[model samples]
Target: MENPPPKLQVKVTADASGSEKTVHSSGLSVRSLLKFSVSATLGGKDLTPEELGELLSNGDGLIRFKGEWVRVDARKVRDLMDRWTQAARMMSSLGIPLVQGLRMLVNGPSGQLVQIPEPDEDCVMEPGQNLRQTLDILAGKVPVSIPELPSRLDALMRPYQKEGFSFLYRITEQGFGACLADDMGLGKTLQAIAWLDTLRRKGRLEGLPALIVAPASLLSNWKEEAQRFAPELILRIMHPSSPDPWQPEKNLRRKDCHAVITTYGMAARTSALADLHFPAIILDEAQAIKNAGSARSRAIRSLHGERRIALSGTPVENNLNELWSLMEFLNPGLLGSRKSFESFTRSLERGYAPLRRLVRPFILRRMKTDPALVPDLPDKTEIPAYCSLTPEQAALYQTQIDMLHAVLDEPDPAARLMLILPILARLKQICNHPAQFQGTDDYAPERSGKFRRLQELCVSIAARQEKTILFTQFRSIIPHLHDLLSGVFGRSGLTLHGGTPIPERQNIVTAFQKESGPPFCILSLKAAGTGLTLTQASHVIHVDRWWNPAVENQATDRAYRIGQHRNVLVHRLICRGTIEDRIDAMLKDKRRMADDLFSGGPEQWLMNMSAEELNNLFFGSPC
Candidate 1:
């Protein structure tokens, strides 16, 4: 048998529909020919380049060359091309990164049967390389042995946490950054400590030490956990107040420490701390860096590190751009330029799966609601208690606005600010309760909206026999809440505030945890939001909206943390049609600009609003 007229010519045409290219010669496209050529080469022994030319030169019959005859299997080529196309399409659409992309192409439906049995004949590809090994591990073809915790680890990990540790190790092994975004109270701290410990034991962190930057309040928490769990590792706490002050840039080389813990405030403010290099840098409550332009985010991003990981329960608490911030910090250039990242994200409201897939290899998140993680965990529900302001409260709100207007006329800007700050405080107070703003013990439910909502909420909590934690920013309003909730609960509850004595705080926490204890507990948000574990209360009522979701979530976690046997219901009491509502909408929108707007925190939020803006925010809609 000689050969068909023309051997095999593949013509490429522009595809308007974006489907695979169409073929012209024998109705076979270049893509098809490429796939076929790969199969012909891989099906048997390799063919030398000169031999390949002779086979293609035949221009027909059964691809006979050398002394061998290889049949071009049409059906096999189609089937194989379809698989390759399927995986390739997914990779292309998601724009999966290099290492992950190759792994997917080789394992995902395409090369499942064979680890790319042989390189494609058309392209220059290295066969039998490290990439194949990585693919093997990713696809589970090569078993990933979950290593035991270091002998020095005094702490134990949950089954899921151990899995998390393995995930981080595998990704970093490929020279990539990762974000550990497990839900709040899910032991992200422990998983991070485990990663550091593993690296320490493996002697992989020789030239540089690991850095942990977190909120000032949480610096102690990290120190405590590292001491309790990674007892084998040395620790350094960077502090300005210490007699032997620590400065990372100058002192880092001389320090003999496995990990350095510092606050985002300290890190951002101190040049030395921000300039020090770390083998690994982990940011706890990573939302602090959600604003790419903020001093802390800028400072943390400036610090050099071999591996970067972010720990946050609410990674995108407000919006998608915040996710970009975290991603930018983790894998800077991986997501492409910020402008393009933002442009593409705008179209991803309903369909974010593609973006998720792209970053899948770099992010590991497990919510407590996962049945495998917490089989017996109770349901946690979030409810918004929208309320209307009482007519009397509305009247008082107007009076405060008037005072704010009067203060705007102060000749000195500083004096105007002094008056404006107190006016905003008064406005929030009037919203909480008219009596609070008046500096009197007026306890009239008819004068407040939040009070009425709390009253309504109590009836339901009473019927369910569940405990509640009522958090307010104003301590002055707590007595009113305690008084009001006591009647509904039919028993007095506990109250903790900033001024509560240190010794008495534990007693208050212990009492509230008991099943037979009070049905509700009240606290000022700043005081009890961080340290306590009040899991006994299944219901957490936000008497007012805290500016940051992270702060509010921290408060809610008092009950949502581990050890709660019953479902938790979080009720956010918000007054409708006011500044609160406007701010609520801003948080909901979560656009990139909104992140910058909110990044300054509450003081900036209050002070930065122009008089006109503040006026519109308050008077734009009826209370």
Candidate 2:
């Protein structure tokens, strides 16, 4: 009576091409069962339409099909049943694009993607588009397309650069946004210009001018590159201080300019840009809008554009949110909203693979290490410039560590995390110099061993008359480092931090790049780490270590990028017998252990380390 104990197993399998969605139960395939069940109901025999529905509703149930009872669980069959119904609905209504429908079906109830098979004709992509080709593109398999750069491009593109241009070409043709995330100095700007030129050649630029937004520091670079590569295209730079910001608007209205270049800050601050429509909007160093809640991101969403492209080397420096933000800007709502993405990600134990699949088609990334991209790039060697803390620094560092230990002992684990963050901040500051934490602004070189080592290195560096980038994570230490570097290099140096005005950042970078310019450029890690092309600097010095090695590597890449022919040296300053040394080792271990699938930042994991581990990290000093 209870429908013989369910023993039947329902196996659902997608064919290799994903064209067929087959369900098999009791040795009967979906196609065969489709007819067998229908005939039984039509003949008024053992099963009815309602009986079939009832069978599907109960996980453990018996179904009488042609005199034999089949045992099965409805739980396993419901997903396919539901999908079958939905697919029929979609087919009868407006058909869905094969790629889009496949993407949706694969991301199941819990965001886990099922195997992809050949799509149904109703789900096939637009006429002439191949699903396999699209998959190849998403997976970054360059499928032997004749590599071509823009005919009008004044500069010669490398073979890999040409390949990059083609990827842009194909994606834009398919009506999708792109993220050209080539490593620092792999010619992303040039590739973009080439793509724009192709659009012009194809007459896609007739409706409206494309918009290019970058950091205020790179506005000049964009202008200069435009002038150099696409001389035929009229490019206008829109800025707040320009004598006539309206000129760009007038140009757009009359369609005079091929492209309008503006800074993210100006685009957010200037009301006029908010309403402007363009055929394409390209964001350079787009990580500037990595925070979804930032005004720049909101401003970007408001602008109307048919196509979006984001260029950044370090797209997701801290967490997956950064990648989500970049992808959202490039293709709004394609990955769902920020809240939806967060919820979906939190539901999975490790969502990196799913996250990659969801955004792969939209973002095309190439790294400099690919010999095909940068064959001639000189090798870079990173040396640990170890220093013993001056007695003053050592004393303050000890005191700070003791204070953090007290904070870590708080009753509330959450409260302890709150306390630990600031404590870590203070510890790093004390390592830099006692003066930084003491609020005395006394960054006397001799008071800190790291500072003393920096002086010794800079003296030798200055003798070579080569440029260097001095990077520190803390803004408060900039003045101190600048003063010391100025005396050592015997000339003024440029300093950049988060507080630096957007309009003036370009000027500082340009001044630092000139042959007669400052010998050193002091920059905070977060502000100047990613977008900068300070190839003039042959040496990169890390005044203090960030918790993440990728971040440190990004900062170093500001100098060790494509342009420099000279052998580059990277110096990471670490206090020999302190928390910095222990952390440096721990970071290396963690990176090796995680092998890049690691999602959370180092600080979060550090907080979870056992108290015994913490004691070992803080109490013992390694030289």
Per-residue lDDT tens digits for candidate 1, residues 251-279, read 65543678877777787887765555678
Give me candidate 1's TM-score against the actual structure: 0.62
What's the lDDT for residue 579 in model 2? 74
Q: How accurate locally is residue 489 in candidate 1, as Cα lDDT from 0 to 100?
A: 82
In model 2, where do residues sit more than 4 Å from their true spots? 1-83, 95-100, 108-155, 246-251, 270-274, 293-295, 337-340, 343-355, 499-504, 593-603, 610-613, 620-623
TM-score of each: 0.62, 0.78
Per residue, candidate 2 scores C-alpha lDDT tens digits across 230-343 of 887767778765555535446655456778888787788877766766788898888788877887788876777666788887787666677778866766555665776777
Total backbone collisions, model 2: 9
Best by lDDT: 2
Q: For residue 164, what is the lDDT in candidate 2?
A: 75
